[model samples]
Target: MPLLFLLRLQHIPLPVRVALSEEVRLVSVLVATGLIEADFAPVRPTGPDAASRIATVKRITEEGLAEIAKMSDAPKFAKTSMRFARGLRLM
Candidate 1:
């Protein structure tokens, strides 16, 4: 899988600015919702065998891609990619 990149364009409210842990929770929720699939791991390596992680989006289900496309086509989400994605960067 490719690495996800984030760009901070401006300051969003504290409520909207989700922490890494919260973002991971949201990704787990998304996976539970069947919209996408992800692999979870520690933010910082705990051991030599530990893997780096950031709730990587290993793959998007067909439904997930369709939903994303639908979101982009919508008026509200068209220009708000980051918000629409929550904290996960789409590939």
Candidate 2:
């Protein structure tokens, strides 16, 4: 699910993705393996709204897709497979 989401959605914020079911663990694993970088610090909001804080968070690396292709458990659906194939093109 996380893999598919990542494939379809570009520039997704890390906090928002973690709110998805079971994605926190998946994202953590991906981050640990250098597939994703979570070093982004969201822009601090002047207002007290929590939503604004969440909206500012983001994390990514240039090689995110390529790293996903190297994973053994990459998603198998056609769309995801096609993306993975493309990701592997430069390898």
Estimate the overall C-alpha local distance difference test score of candidate 1: 0.52
The positional error of residue 41 in candidate 2, measured at the CA in angstroms, is 12
TM-score on alpha carbons, each prediction:
0.44, 0.38
**Candidate 2 colliding pairs:** none
**lDDT to native, each model:** 0.52, 0.49
Candidate 1 vs. true structure, TM-score:
0.44
Write model 2 residue lDDT over 1-91, tens digit each, in one string.
5565455435553545343325544555556666565432344556553322122114545677675565435445666879878887553
Displacement of residue 50 (Cα, Å) in model 1 is 15
Question: Tens-digit lDDT track for model 1 on 1-91?
Answer: 1112111201222113232654566657667867666776556767764434566655566776566656547766555775767878678
Q: Between which residue pairs do clashes occur in model 1?
A: none
Error of 2 at 7 (Å): 1.3
